[model samples]
Target: MRNLFFLCAFLLLAVACKSPEARRPVQRSSGSFIKESAERNKKLYKKEEAIINKIIAQNSDKDFESNPNGFWYFYNVKDTLSTVMPKYGDVVTFTYDVKNLEGTTIVSEKEIGLQQYQVDQSNQELISGIREGLKVMKEGETVTFLFPSYKAFGYYGIEEKLGANVPIQSTITLRSIESSEEN
Candidate 1:
């Protein structure tokens, strides 16, 4: 009888006590964090713009055209007669070479073989620069895209595959793009 009385009292006490987490309301302010993050990203974007501008000015051979996404590009070679271009979901095959600000080669099509990508068609997503640039070119055109890390490969720098990091601008040439449907 005494043991039962103690057990009942313990259970009652436990039930009366509130959880610590429940008692304290969360203090984090989502809006403040978001505002701060946006400011930081804006600064990063500006730095990238500066780097891209410098590269464009230094290269005399390439006449760059800017895009809203903060990259600049120029056609090294383009088909004057072909009007057909790659569209979304179209499979595109081309050769490319990836290089960094210092003109160091990151990867070359010669090292790998003809690269194949479906236009905005893959769950395996290509970088923003490549996808957007492809949309602008005809099958026989070759475009050189100059963009910052954010457009190429942000913070996570293609460590093993392509070694890229922010503040580092890269230039990639879409040597030749042919739609799979054409073949």
Candidate 2:
């Protein structure tokens, strides 16, 4: 009887010690949502490209790069924001407000103050597109980049809350408020 009791206790303890990874719920719903979103985003992206191309062809003021993978446009500002580009390992801080093209607030840090993060560290610290976008900027420079869903969150929106058919295009306006001196 004592041996049986010990075996049960050992089994309980072993199970308790298992890492969270072992307990993670199977992400069937999220996986399916992502697959559907990717399909929808592809069609929307093509439409966006056509619209952008039409706009560019009609206007001479805007300069941009066009390609199937993604598009980037740069506008020269009258005031020089900053020249400091944070290096790969450096920590950078900034304040930002994200909105739709019509200026509907989707996210903002103005009420919350500045946000800080270390560049290039993946996973929880930063989104892949934000990481990629920051690498191209310098301190004090403000840039607005429109990212397709693949560059933003791929097929899965952050937290799987954003709908599959919801467009993936996001206009990210970034200001490099500060960077570590070592950067």
Top of the candidates by TM-score:
1
Could you say which candidate leads in lDDT? 1
> Scored by CA lDDT, what does every candidate get?
0.71, 0.56
> In candidate 1, what are the lDDT values of residues 1-183, reduced to their tens digit?
999999999999998895665555568665988899779878888887887787888897777899886678888776789777777667777666677767677777577566678777676556777777777777766677877777778767676866535543333344445556644
How far residue 7's Cα lies from its native spot in candidate 2, in Å, is: 42
* Tens-place lDDT digits, model 2, residues 52-123: 556557656766554344745454331365556667667777655444333455555565356676776534
Q: Report the Cα lDDT for candidate 1.
A: 0.71
Q: How many backbone clashes does every candidate have?
A: 1, 1
| Model 2's TM-score against the true structure | 0.54
lDDT score of residue 117 within candidate 1: 80
Clashing pairs in 1: 157-164
